[model samples]
Target: MKQLVRFFIIGMLVSGVLLYLISSLNQSQGYTGGNTLTIFNWGDYIDEELITQFEAETGIKIVYETFDSNEAMMTKIEQGGTSYDIAVPSEYMIDKMRQEDLLIPLDHDKLPNLKNIDERFLDLPFDPDNIYSVPYFWGTVGITYNAELLPDKTFTSWNDLWDPDLKNEIILIDGAREIIGMGLNSLGYSLNDTNKAHLQEAFDKLGTLTPNIKAIVGDENKLLMQNNEAAVAVLWSGDAADIMWENEAIDYVIPEEGSNLWFDNIVIPKTAKNIEAAHAFINFMLDAKVAAQNTEYVAYSTPNQAALQYMDPEMVADERFYPPPALTEKLEVYQNLGKRNLAYYNDLFLAFKMYGK
Candidate 1:
C-alpha cells in the first residue's frame, strides 16, 4: 500500500510540472517576448483579418484598440497612459498632431508601396511631403435623406436643408467643424475660411438650421436615418453608402455647392516605441491584397490605386460612391486653423448648439 501511495504521489508531481511547462510555453507564444505592436484606430475601421495575417507574417503580435471619434483618440493619447505604435487620424487632426510635433516623420523608404497611392493625395497642405502620414481611406461628407418621406423635395443643394419644408425633419451630425463647414459650403464661403465675417455668416446660417434639426447626434443618427425617423442626415459618404445599401428609400448626395473631401491616414505618434514593427504593419497594410481586403471590410474608398483591381467592379464603377474628376473639383479638404481660430470655431459651434436663432 505504501509503495502504491508513493507511485501515485510521483505521478501527480510529474503531471503538475508538465502542466506548468505547457502554460509557460503558451504564455511565450501568445505574448511575443515583448515584441507585440500596439495599434490604435477607429472602431470597425480595419479588416481584423489583416491584423492576424500581419502577426502570422511578421511573428509580431498586435495589441489593437479602438476609439469612436477623433476627439476620444486624441484625448487618450494626450492623457499618456498608453503608447500606441500606430494611430489613424483624419487629415485635419494630422495637421493638429503635426503642429504639436506629436507625430514622428515616417521613413518613406520603408513604405515603398506608397507609389500605389494616387498622386493627388500626396503633398497636400497637411503633411505636404507625406512625412508623417499614409492614406488609409478617403471620402466626402454629404447628405443622406429619406426621399420617400419628402417626395416633393428635390434636395439638389445644401440650401434645400434650409427650406422651411424640412423643419423638424433633419438630424445633423453632432460635429462642430462638420456642422460649421456645411454652413460655410452652403453660403459660398470656404469651409476652412478663417475670416471673422465668414464664420459669423456660417454661424448665423447654422442658427437658422438649429430649430429645424430634430437632433444633433453621432452614430445614433445612423439608426435614426435607417429607421426613416429623420428625413435627412448629413454624414460621411461611406456611412451613407452603407445605410443606403440597406434601405432603398434613402439616397446620398453631395450638394451641388460642394462639400468636404477627407482622408484618414495611418501615422506613427512621436511616443511610438515599436517603430520598426509599426513600419512593418503599415507596409503590410499597403500590400495590394491587404489594401483591397481592408477597402471591402471598411466599405470606404481606398487611395491605393493598385488595390482597385481587386475590388468589386460594380462598386468601383459606381460614381456615387467614388467621386469622379468633375465631382472631385468641388470637394474641399479641411485644414487646421491656428489654435485661437480653432478655439473660436469650437465656441461658435457650442453657442449655436446652445442658442437657436
Candidate 2:
C-alpha cells in the first residue's frame, strides 16, 4: 500500500512539471492565434519582395494595407480603433496626426540603423528633432513634360502650365493644396497663404489652367502620361521616374520659382499593437544597404547620406531624383496650416471647381 502511494505521488509530480512546461510554451508562442504586424501606407509604394525578405529575416508576418489620402487613413484608424504597427505618411499629415494625439513618440535609440539617414533631411519643422517619424522617401512635386509632344516650347515655371499650347493636354494634381499651391507659387505668394486676396488670386490662376487641363488626377498621372493622354502634368518625382523608364521621352523639371520639398515618413501610431516590432522594421529599412535598394527600386530620393554612398551613381545623379544644388536651396518644405486655414483652402478649391470651370 505504501509502494502504491509512492507511485501515485511520483505520477502527480511528473504531471505538474508537464503542465508547467506546457504553460510556458504557450506563453512563449505569444498571444492566442499568432503575431502579425499590420502596416498602413500609400499604394504601390514599397517593394513586395523586400517585404517578404523582411518577413523571412525577422519571422514576423507583414500585413499591409493602403489608403489614397491621409484623411481617409486617419478616419479609418479612428473609427475602426485599428491597431497598426507602422504607417507611412507625408510631412503635413504627420503634423496632423501629432496634433490629434494619434501618434506615439519614437525612441530613436531603438533605431541604430538611423545613422544611415542624411542629417540634412532630419529635424524638420513637422517632426523637429526627429522624435516622431523617420523619413522613408523624399521627393518634390514637379512638372513632367513629354519632350516629344512639345519640342518647340520651353517649360520653366508654374506659369508655363497656362500656355495655350497645353490646353486639353495637361493634367493637374488632384489635391487642392498642390493645385492651389502651384498657383500661389506662380503668383509669388506663400503656399500656405490664408489671406482672402491671395487665395482669390490663386483661384483665378488655377481657373486659367483649368481650361487647359485634361484631367485633375490623384495617382494616375504616370499611366496617363505613358499612354500619351497627358502631355504635361504636375507629378510626384517617383511616379515621373517610373513612367520615364518606359518612355524616355518624358522629362521632369522643377518650376523655376521653386516647389515643395516633401518627405514621407514611417510613424508608429499611438494605437500600435506591436511597438518593438515596429522599431525593428524601421531600423531594418533604415539600414544603408536596404535604403539604397529601396530608393533604387522605388526611384525616389533617399534621406540617407550613408545609403547614397551605397547607391548606384546613376540614381544619385538623376536630376529628377536629385535636383541641382541651387534648386535645392530655393525649395521649401510644407508645414501643417491650422484648421481655419485648411477650411479656407478647401473652400478655395471648391470655388475653383464650381466657378473657375
**Whole-model Cα lDDT per candidate?**
0.87, 0.84
TM value for model 1: 0.88
Candidate 2: C-alpha RMSD to true structure equals: 9.4
TM-score of each: 0.88, 0.85
Off by over 4 Å in 1: 1-26
Candidate 1 Cα lDDT to native: 0.87
Candidate 1 clashes between residue pairs 3 or more apart in a chain or in different chains: none
Clashing pairs in 2: none
Q: In model 1, how large is the Cα lDDT of residue 109?
A: 91
For residues 1-357, could you state the per-residue lDDT of candidate 1 as single tens digits? 999999999999999999999879868767543587889998889988888899888889888899888878887777776779999998988988887778899999998888888888888888898999998999988889888998877777898898888889888887888889998999988788999999999999889887788988988988888888999999999789789878899988888888998999999987688899999889889888899988888888888888899998987887766878887888888887778998999999999889753
lDDT value, candidate 2, whole model: 0.84
lDDT of 2 at 124: 94
Off by over 4 Å in 2: 1-35
